[model samples]
Target: MKTFNAKVNVTLKKSVLDPQGQTVLEALHSLGYKGTENLRVGKYFEVTLNAQDENSAKTQLKEMCEKLLVNTVIEQYEVHLS
Candidate 1:
């Protein structure tokens, strides 16, 4: 088996409201960060997995995201592997 390193990013859908991100944006503005009108907050995960090949690794990663890491109803996820 080959070891794979994966990076997963989970974020709210575009149509969803992100209160935490908004709060952070407000804080940035208060801290004199200008021209930063748009911001969003998301979750990041680094995962290590053992798989037979790249395709298998990718499939396992997606399964992990779909099963538990992402809320498909309100959130989306992207997976990158190395």
Candidate 2:
């Protein structure tokens, strides 16, 4: 088996409301920054996997994302394998 590294990014769907992001934006505005606009917050995950090939590692990472890493109801994920 080969060891691979995976980077996962989880973000709220465009339609979803991000209260944390809004709060940050408001804070920035309060700090006198006027150029800030609609802000969104997300998560990042880095993992190591052992598999036969890059494809296999990616497949496993996808499963891992769907099963535990992200909330399917409100989040979308992008995966990078290296």
Best-performing candidate as measured by TM-score: 1
Model 2 lDDT tens row, 1-82: 9999889999999989999999999999999999998788999999988999988988899899999999999999999888
Give the poorly placed runs of model 2, Cα more than 4 Å off: none
State in Å the error of residue 45, model 1: 0.4
**TM-score, one value per model:** 0.97, 0.93
* 10 residues in a row with least lDDT, candidate 2: 32-41
Clashing pairs in 1: none
Query: Which lDDT tens digits does candidate 1 get at residues 8-34?
Result: 999999999999999999999999998
State each model's CA lDDT, in order.
0.95, 0.93
Clashes of each: 0, 0
Best by lDDT: 1
